[model samples]
Target: MLLEVKDLHASIGGKEILKGLSLTIKAGEVHAIMGPNGSGKSTLAQILAGREGYEVTAGSVRYNGVNLLDLEPEGRAQAGLFLGFQYPVEIPGVNNVYLLKAALNARQKAAGKPEIDAVSFMRLVKEKAALMEMDQSFLSRSVNEGFSGGEKKRNEIFQMAVLEPTLAILDETDSGLDIDALKVVANGVNLQRRDDRSVLLITHYQRLLDYIEPDYVHVLANGKIIHSGDKSLALQLEAEGYDALMAKAAG
Candidate 1:
């Protein structure tokens, strides 16, 4: 397994959100996590990304055979974990290009590789931007400052392209996007798919799945995965809704 969570338990603000959640993802697979509101979907993503304030009361998370919980946020990134936030942060004074360059170089340095020069970095940014249909001028703008919802999501995928993480976790990436923007974001994600890379898509709606089809879909409810199946499961959920799943779980 490329990633594994065993009997996972996590909480925030003294309230338990995830209780004994377990999951496993191997290389070259895409896993979609769909759930109703407050199902601990985002919390799972945050925990995997090493976000502070989420207390892990029990269980273990292993990535590439290393204890993922032991690593800090930066350490997790350097270890090839990337998370696309539901709400991308705005860095008022930071140029988007500069931020990407710095992040790429940092990851490279951590992996014992030489840093990419300005020329090579710019070339990469241009290529990735074109793939995402992003405007060239946007690279010079401040990081996510004043960006529209679609722009911010596309920018996040652009960063993912440059960083080339082994495992990418997208937390509600399709939430605020319109149909067109959703297609663009999904196209960008599809272009980045490789035989060795994996994606964990956390979403509430099944619309996003129409574009970026997953190998497996898991239904998360009450902080645990109540059901899991192939891509067909998503369509079923869309048709029958969470109430059906809830009723089934109750029985």
Candidate 2:
């Protein structure tokens, strides 16, 4: 198992958001989490990425057999864990490629590896940019400073591609994208999928699954996963909505 969350209970500002949530993701598997608003999907992703402001009240999260909750956010990133935020932040003066290079070097340094050379780094970035169908000029601009919603989301995936994280948690990456942009982002994700990488996609809609099919689809309700099935489950939820299946789970 790449990640294991057992009976996780977490809260923010004394209010519980994740209650008895459990999940496991093995290497190379893609899992999609779907739920209504306020179901704690993003909370789960945030906690896994070692975000602050959320307290773990009970239970445990183990990543690659390590006590994941004990690691700091930067530690988690260096350990090959990546989180793509629902809203990508804008850094006004930091060049996009510069940030990615620094991040990559940091991770490499943590692993006792040499920093990637300039030539190799540029080659890799350009290759990934082409994969995301991004203009080369965008790489030189400040990170997400003036990017559209779709462009920001695609840039997050582009960062994921370059970093080549072992486990990626994408929180609503497909939320505001049009069909064309969605396909571009999905394609970028698909091309990066490998036997050594795992992806956890938190989404509210089923349309994303149409492009990047997951091995498992999980329904989260009231802070816990109420049900799980294959890709067909997403189609079911799309067709019938959450009420019917959630009702069945309640029974």
TM-score of 2: 0.98
lDDT by residue (tens digit), candidate 2, 127-162: 999999999999999999999999999999999999
Count of backbone collisions in candidate 1: 0
Instruction: For model 1, give the 10-residue run with minimal summed lDDT.
Output: 98-107
Which stretches of model 1 miss by more than 4 angstroms? none
| TM-score per candidate, chains pooled | 0.99, 0.98
By summed lDDT, the worst window of 10 consecutive residues in model 2 runs over 43-52
How much does candidate 1 score in TM-score? Answer: 0.99
Candidate 2: segments with Cα more than 4 A from true spot: none
Candidate with best lDDT = 2
lDDT of each: 0.95, 0.95
151 Cα displacement, candidate 1 (Å): 0.5
